[model samples]
Target: MSQRSFRRSIAIWLAALFAAYLALAYFAAPEFWTFRDRGFRTQHFEMVTHTPQGIPGDPINVGLVGTQKEVVHAFAVAGWDTADAVTLKTAIEIGESVLFDHPYPDAPVSRLLFDGRAQDLAFEKPVGAPAPRRDDGRVWETPCGGGGGRPRWGGSASFDRGVGLSHDTGAVTHHIGPDIDAERDFLMRDLATAGVLISTGDISGVGATSTGRNGGGDPYFTDGEAIVGILKQ
Candidate 1:
């Protein structure tokens, strides 16, 4: 074959191969994975939590496949303190801590509801001043069971950026940062680093949202994926 003709044929073959690769990588593979994951998606319970007044709170962005004791131990190993329930004395302590720039490592967090009940467990990791920044996760015992019939704990992980007034009710509250997915990943990373996580996988949540507002009217965004960790047994 002529040199020019041979070169042209080779160029055409390379272009076709690249196009096929793109099709599989961007389209076919995603579709296949989605189909495979549909069964797992249906196992999730409530996608978001609600406030005392029934307003939608934060979206569930993390989960744990374990018993209550295992769940608590995992967070503890990850350097998170189980939050104290909001009460008169604890409330006053958090208020004082915030006002005086003190570190109340296990401060009380406002209650958020899932399945018409207050969170089964809540954990917090204070950052710098407890009032200005903190990592929080509110967990609920989900009806769905994981492998080996272990109870699943669905949770909403969020970062409290600062204390402020609630935009909806004018009540005092903590405003969360918008990128909740970052908080979710951060929590998972902490657990993994602490060797408390056996394995991690993603499930569907409130779907991808760029303009979601929680009960406090604080704006937030997420990739709509919840990471579920199987804690070390």
Candidate 2:
């Protein structure tokens, strides 16, 4: 350890691998070429897969793409950005809604929440169960994405179903009914104190999304996100 301190420890490990390749080329997965971009144009799967969103819960079908500001700057540097707090609280709730002890208000059946909604979802049957859920029967709705098919409240939805998530109290309960009521008044309150529920109107079954307008607190709804029903411990 003396040839000029082994070239100063290889120039401090090459300046920490060029500052971790410029912070993963401006935030991880920039097509991964290096030295400030090359041919990095990701965001594909144009006609993605996965299905089912409402009525059975357990969501996973999001494949819109093009919201990458380094994926909201790595969740605002890992402070768990709620999509940047829905651009600062315009509105953005996501998950949780109960009625439980069903009797009949609108009656289709409900209890939902399914927290984190179903992070990185892909399950057709593997969140744990005897497995039998499949609306893969039909309703592959599409068109109006401006590119061709589904986006006017369209295509591939569902990230959690037969729901059963519980980070102890980070809740998740579903079996929905009573029309859904803004996802059942967001499980009986603005997601306990707004962890996230920013739709606008049309909670059809009273939960997932409707957007037909009315009592959605009118703030210009866009896309979706749900879950919380209570239990943060």
**Highest lDDT scorer:** 1
- How accurate locally, in lDDT, is each candidate? 0.85, 0.26
Q: Which candidate is the best by TM-score?
A: 1
lDDT of 2 by residue, 93-204 (tens): 1221122322111112122222212122111211222221111100122233422222222122221233342211112322112222233232224222443222222222
Write candidate 1's Cα lDDT for 136-225 as tens digits.
Answer: 999999788987899998899999999987776556689999999999999999999999988999999999999999978899999999
TM-score of 1: 0.79
TM-score of each: 0.79, 0.19
lDDT of 2 at 191: 28
Off by over 4 Å in 2: 1-11, 23-29, 32-45, 49-82, 85-151, 155-233
Q: Weakest 10 consecutive residues, lDDT, candidate 2?
A: 132-141
lDDT of 1 at 31: 57
